[model samples]
Target: MTRTSSAPLRSPVAALLAVLLAASGVLLGAGGAQAAGYRYWSFWEGDGKSWAYATQGPSLVRPDDGTVQGFRFAVSEDSADADRPRHAPDFGAICADTPAKGGAKRVALVIDPGTTEDAPAGEKPPALRTACAQVAPDASSAEALASVAKPLRYDSSAMICAISGYPKSGCGEQVSGDGSKKDGSGKPTDDASASASASSAPAADDGDSGGGPSAGLLLGIGAVLLLGVAAVFQARRRR
Candidate 1:
């Protein structure tokens, strides 16, 4: 004679595993949410007269004596690939070092031509600084930098990087050492769509500034699909 036991059957460990895996999938989906529009930095180093691209971000590089650090505003290829072709910056012109005149600080700045439409109205750039300008009549970094009497010497302590928006609210502000500056009315001191952030190095610049969806999203989707497959397997095992 066979006797029936009153004990109930337990669910397989696979069911528990499946729940944890699903929770992990949810967390993975949130990884890239911090991306507030993908603007990043590209670094360069200067020979006191000429410049070269940097292999690593500024944070990894600590300039010794006489070493000059340089940075150029690099937009995403999507933004840069249009008619406006930006050449690598000219260090001799952009980083032109001049002795202080009349005990006033010498500052040099370059503006990108593509960003001219964003420039605010009613304000003119200061005249005393050195600017290396592009030959084109249109607005350009070289053309903007050219107006100044002399380009400021590159400093490891402080660097001038380009910020592309006003109120300085995006990637540029994040990189700015001084942070955002407000006027009497709490409006941003910078009215130009494209402005410079004179800040410290060793902070290192970011990469891949474009804000579009690309390979990363595709890979993420694939991962989610794979996780779904795993959940299906766990369900089958529970049955």
Candidate 2:
């Protein structure tokens, strides 16, 4: 009788391989989710005395009433693109921030006019972008406008980044709102909008001073399709 060659049993090995692959796929998907949702960029510039910057804000939240509140914008000293008919100035960076809770932990921030850096997922801020902003927190306030009725330094060296909304519930007992915008009287201050954290940033200066944010030209971060897809991807990968 002729001897016939037999194939080795492959069940155990195939199962092992499948398990490994599934685990890897899960890990990859999680990483991608986190990467997709966040304000991942920042930029700014200075011409000795004056400077400008930009940034993106947290992902847009679709509440029951259909009101959208989020910001991603650029700040500039000169009206760039001015020569291009109805247009805006060239921005430096688009800074985006989110609250510790109430929303997605990640917010993708993107700006137009020009781009110097487009970072990959899970990117740590580079030294250049980090140095782009100076902590002139004082400059952000109206105190700078004290001596001059119409702040002179503000036009050149101030930043305005305050944003809040209407029909809000107890939005500002601490920063800007005088509890007028809230819906009811008994609501606790703890129930304020989660993203209202930055509400104080601009409200403190403009709201209390009764003069509005001095920057007048503060930047914004809008919800564009480009940002929407990117942010969704980030959420999936992180999972």
1-239: candidate 1 lDDT, tens digit per residue = 77543232224445555665676556554543322211223344555555555544343443432234433433322212212213333444544655434423332333332233222233222211224322223332222332432343222222333323221322322311122222233211231112222221122224432333335655665776677677657665654
Candidate 2 per-residue lDDT over residues 13-125, each given as its tens digit? 34545655565555444433321111111122222233333121122221121111222221111122011111122123211232223322211111221122222223222
- Candidate 2, which segments miss by more than 4 Å at Cα? 1-8, 36-43, 48-239
* Steric overlap count per candidate: 21, 28
Specify the highest-lDDT model's number.
1
lDDT for 57 (candidate 1): 37
Total clashes in model 1, counting residue pairs 3 or more apart in sequence or in different chains? 21
Q: Model 2 Cα displacement at 207 (Å)?
A: 38
Task: Tell me how candidate 1 scores on lDDT.
Answer: 0.35
Models 1 onward score TM values of 0.31, 0.24
- In candidate 2 the C-alpha lDDT for residue 213 amounts to 26
